[model samples]
Target: MAKITFHGAAGTVTGSKYLIEAGQAKVLVDCGLFQGMKQLRLLNWKQLPFAASSVDAVVLTHAHIDHIGFLPRFVRDGFRRKVVCTPATKELAKLLLLDSAKNQKRDAAYLNRKHLTKHSPALPLYDVKDARRALHRLKAVARGEWHELSDPIWVRFHDAGHLLGSNMIEMEIRDRDPPLRLLFSGDVGRYDAPLYFDPSPPPPCDYLICESTYGDRDHPDEDVLEILAEKVNQAYARGGVMLFAAFAVGRSQQLIYLLQVLMHEGRIPKIPIFLDSPMAVDATRIFRTFSKDHDLSEGELAPPNSVLDGPNVELVREHNRSKQLNNVKGPAVIISSSGMMTGGRILFHLKRRLPDPKNTILLGGYMAAGTRGRDLQRGRPTIRIHGWDVPVRAAIDSVSGLSGHAGRSELLRWLKDLPKPKKTFITHGEPDSAESFAAALRDQYQFETVIPQLGESFELGE
Candidate 1:
C-alpha cells in the first residue's frame, strides 16, 4: 500500500517537507529548510531519516524559502533528481537559493569571527557552488499540465496565488485499484490580493494536505492603501525613515507597487524609496519578466514610466551603498528582507533605525514566532542583534492586508468548493493555529482532519 510521511512543517509554520511512497517510486514534495527558533533551525544540520538518493524526484509548490529553500542542501546531500516547479518558480528559486547560500556563508563567517557559534569553526549549510549545482537540476513545466514522475505516478501544478510562482500540487497514484488522488495546498493566498489571482479551486482528492499559517485568525477590515498612507504620512511627519521589513520576493514587490499607487493618487507624499536587498532587486526584475504570472496589467508593469518603477526609487545592490543608507534621512521609505527579521539586509537597517523614536518600522506581513519581528510586535523593550541589545524605541506598525497567507475565513473560502476528502491533514502552523483550523474544518465541512506530528506516517489507502 502507498504511504506518506510528514518530514517537516507538520506542527510548525516553516520547513515544509513531505514524503510519498507508492510501489517502488518515491517522490518528495517541497523540501525546505526550517527557520525560526534555534531548535527548528538545528534540524537543518541533522541528516534526513530517509536516504536522499532513494527519492526519484522532488516537486515544489512555490519559491518561498520555507517551501523551497532546502534544495541546495538536499542537492549537496546527494539528491540527484530533477526539482520540478513552474517556470517562474524555477527562475525565482535560483535567486532565492543563491541568496540563501550567500547568507549562510556570511552568517557563519560572522559567528566564527565573533566566537559566538557552538561549533569550533562555524560552517555554512551549503555554499554557492552547491546552490549553483542545484540550479542546474531545476526543470520548469507549464502550470495545469499533468507530468509523469515514474510509472503510474503523475503530478500537476495549479496556481496557489500565494506568490508570483506559487502552486498547489495534485498527485495521482495510478497503481492502486482506485487511483488515490491527493492535493497539497501550498500556502494558499488571500482572495482578491493585488499582483496575484485568487487561488485555484482544489481538485477532488481522496486526501488533502493543507497549510494553516493564519488558521486561527483573520486580517482586520481596513483598506491597505489607507493604512499605508497613514503610516507613510506619520513617518514622513516625524522626519525619519520608514523602514519596511519584507520578504524579498513577493512582499517587497508588493510594497513598491503600492507605494507608487499611493503616490500617484496623492494620498501620500512621493518620498524617496530604497530597495536595499540584492535578492529583492533581482526578484523585482523577475517580477517584471513574468508579468503574465501575476495579476498586474501590462500598463502597470510596463517600463520607462511603469508603476513598478519611479524616478524617486533606488535599488541598492552594493555593500558600500547599503551602508550609506545609514545616513539616509527621514521622509524616505526603505524596504529590505527577511520579512520575519530572522536574517537579511533588514537586520542592518533595524539596528540603525530601531533606536530612534522618530523612525518607524513597518512589518509587511506575518512574523513567525521566535523571530525579531514577532518580538517587536509583542512590545519587547529591546531586541538582540549582533550580540548586543538594541533598544526598541522606534514606532512599530503593521499593515493589515499585506499578508500573503490566507486567513481563517479565506482558507475556508478556498476550501469551500472542494469535496470533503476522506482525510485532511493540517500542517504548516503552530499547534494552536493548526488545531483551531482542524476543528473548524471538522465542524464546518465534516472533514476527517488530523494534525500530524512531525515524522508521523500514515497509510494512503485501505
Candidate 2:
C-alpha cells in the first residue's frame, strides 16, 4: 500500500513537509521549517515523526525558505540522500539557505549578548556549514520532464510561476492496481503578474494537494501603477523616504518593473532609488539569466531602457554603500529583503527610519502573525527591534495587489481545468484559510476534500 503523511504546512503558511511511503521506497517532499508564532516556531526543533535517514530522497518544490527551510536541519539530522529540484531552484536555494543560516547565527549571537533568550546560551538552528553541507546533496532537474524514482514512482515538475524556478510537482505512484497519480501544487502564482508567466495547469491526477494562502480574501484589482505613483509623489512632496520591505525573489523584481514603468510615464518625481540587499541584487542577476521564465517583452529587454537600468537607480552591492544609505537625507526609495521583517537588512532600515514621521514603510508581501511586519500592519505603536523598543511613527502602507500567491478565484479556476480528483488535501495556510478553501471545494465542486492534521497519514487504494 502507498501512504502519504502531512508533516508540516498542514494548516499554516510556513513549513512545508510531506512524506510518501510506497512499497519498498520512502520519499519525502519539501522538508521545510515552521515559521510565525512561538508555538509554531517551537515545532521546528521537535524530532521528525519518521527517521530522516530512512527517507531515500527529497523532492523540492521551490526555493522559498517556507518551502525549503528545514533542509539543513534535515541534513544535519542524518539524511544523506539526493535532494531534487529544478536547476534554477537549486541556485536560488543555495542563496536562500546560506542567508537563512547567517540570519540564525546572527540572531542567536544578538540574543545571547542581550540576555533576551530563555536558553543559557542562544544557538542557531543551523549554521553556514550546515547549509553548505545541504547544498552538496542538491540534484538539479529540468522542468516538464519526468524522471523515474523507482519502478513504481515517477516525478515531473511544472512551472508554478511563483518565483524564478518554483514548480507544481506531479508524482505517479504505481503500488495500486492501476497506479495512483498525486499532484502537489507548491505555491500557485498570480495570473497576469508582471515579469513571470502564469502558472501552467498540469495533467489530471487522482489526488491533489493545493495551497490556500490567499483563500479567505481576494485582492483589489486597483491600478497598482497609479497607486504607486501617488504614494511616491506624496512621499517626495513631504521630503519623506520610502522604504519597501520586499521578498527578494518575486516582489522585489515586480517593484522594480513597476517603479520603472512609473518613472517612464513621468508620474512620480525623480528621486534616488537604491536596491540595498546584496542577496536581492544577486537575485536580480539570476532573474536576468532566467529570462525565459519571465514574460518580459522584447522591448523591455532591449538596449538602454532595460528594467535594470533607470535614471536614478543605484545597486548597492557593498556594505559601506548600504550603510551610506542611512546618511542620505530626504525623498528617496530604498528596497530591501526578508519581506516579513523576520530578519534582514530591512530591520536595520526600519530601526533607522521608523522613528521619523517623514518616512514611509511599504510592505509588499504577506506578513505572518508573529512577524514585525504583521505588528506594524496591525497598528502597533511601538515595535521591538534588536532588543530596543522602536516607536513606529512613520506611515505604513501595503500594496495588496502585488502578492505572488494566487487568490481564491484563481485557485478555483486552476482546479476546474482538471478532471475530478478522487481525493484532495488542502494545506499551506492558516487554519481558517485552509478550512475555508476546503469547504468551498466541497460545496462548489463536490470534491472529497479534507484538511489533514500534522503527522496524519492516509492509505491509498485498497
Candidate 3:
C-alpha cells in the first residue's frame, strides 16, 4: 500500500509540501515555504512534520518559492536525499533560492535595526549557506522519461506549462497484488498563456491529486494585452512611472512577451521599460534557454531587436542601476520582482513611486491576504514597506487574466480530458477554494472527491 499525506498547502495557498510513502521508501514532493499569516509563517521555523532524514527523495514540480522554498530548511534539518526536477527547474531554483536567502537576510537585518520584529534578535528562517547546501542535493531529470523509484513504483514528468520547467507528475505503482497508477497535477498552467506551450494531459490513473488555486472562481476573459496597453497609455499620459510587482519566474516573462507584441503592433507608445530585478533578468535568460518548452513559433524566436532587445528597453542587472530608477523622472515603465510585495526590489520602487498621484502600481498576479500587494489592491490608503509607513496615492491596477494557473472553467475542462479516476483529492488552495472545487467535482463531474486536511493521510489500493 502507498500512503500519502498532506503536510502543507492542503487548506492554504502557500506552504506546498506533500509526503508519499511506499513501504520503506518515502518520497517528499514540493517542500515549499509557508507564507502569509503569522500563524502560518511560524510553521517555517517549527519542526518538520516528519523526520527529514527518513525521506528517501524529493520530487519538485517547479521553481516558485511557494513550491520549492523550504528545501534549504529541509537540508538544514537533515534531508540528505536527492531533490529531483527538470534541468530548467534546477537552474531557475538556484537563482530564486539565492535571492530568497538574500532577501531573508536583508529583512532580518532591517527588522532588528528598526526593532520592528517580535523576535529578540530577528533571525532569517534559513541562511545563504543552508540554501547552498540544499543546492548540492539537486538532481536534474528530463521530461517524458520514466525513472524508477523502487520495485513497486516508477515516476514520469509531463510539461505542466506553468513556467519554464514546471511539470505534472505521474507515478505508476504496483499494488502489492494488483497494479495501480497515481497522478499529481502539481500546478496546472493556463492553456493560452504567452511564451509557454499548453499543459500536457496525462494518461489514465487510478488516483489523482490536483491543485485548485483558482477552482472557485473564473478569471475574466479579457485580453490582457489590450488592458496592459491601456494602462501603459494612461501611465504615460500622467507623466508618472508605472511600477509592476511581477513574479519573476513566469509572470515577468509573460508580461514582457505581451509588451513586445503590443509594441510590435504599434498599439502603445515606445517608452523606456526597465526590468529591475537581477534574479528576474537571470530567469529571462533561463526562459530563453528553454524556448522549445514554449509555444512560440520559429519566427517569434528570431525577431530582430525584439521587445527584449528594443532600444527603449533596459535590463537593470546592477544594484546601482536599479537604485537609479528611483531617481529617474516618470512616464516610463518598471517591472520588478517579489510579486506579492512581500520583499525584493519592488519594495524600493514602491517606496519611491507609490506617493506620486500620477504614478500607477500594476499588480500582475494573485496577491494573498495580508500581503502588501493585496492591501494596495483593496485601495488601502497607506502601506508599510521596509519598516516605514508610506502613503499610497498611486493608482493600483491588476491584470488578472495573466495568471499562470488555470481558472475554474479551464481546470474542469482539463479534468474532463482524463479518464475517470477511482478517487480524486483536491488540494493546494485555501479552505474555501478547496471545498468549492470539491463541490464542483461532485456536482459536475460526478466524481468521488475529498479535500484532505493538513496532516491527513490515506492509504491507496486495497
- On TM-score, the candidate that comes out on top is 1
* Best-fitting candidate, scored by lDDT: 1
Candidate 3 residue lDDT tens string, 180-299: 788889989887777777888867888889899998998888877778888888888889998889998878777777777777778888778899878878887887777677765312
Task: Tell how far residue 5 is off in model 3, in angstroms.
Answer: 0.8
lDDT of 2 by residue, 1-462 (tens): 888999998878888998988888888889888988999999999999788899888999999998888999999999998899998899898889999999899999888998999998988899999999999999999988998665577799998978889999999987666678999999998887777788998679888988989877777777667778877887787687899999887788788878877776677776788998878778877877787777764224324235567768898878788888899777999999879988878889999999999998998667888999899999999998888999999998888767888888888877876888889999998988888888888888898998989888998766
> Is candidate 1 or 2 superior in TM-score?
1
Off by over 4 Å in 1: 297-307
In model 3, the runs with Cα more than 4 Å from the true position are 175-178, 297-307
lDDT of 1 by residue, 1-462 (tens): 889999999899999999999999999999899998989999999899999888899999999999888888898889998889998999999899999999999999999999888898999999999999999998999888999887667999999989988999999999976789999999999886778899999999999999999999999877777888898999899999999998988998888888887787778998899999899988988887887766653123334234358888999999999999999987799999899998878899999999999999998677888899999999999999989899999999999688999999999999998998999999999999999999999999999999999999999988
**Model 2 per-residue lDDT at 117:** 91
Give per-residue lDDT, candidate 1, residue 317.
Answer: 93
- Worst 10-residue stretch by lDDT in candidate 3? 298-307
Q: Kindly report which residue pairs in candidate 1 clash with one another.
A: none
lDDT of 2 at 21: 83
TM-scores for candidates 1 onward, in order: 0.98, 0.96, 0.96
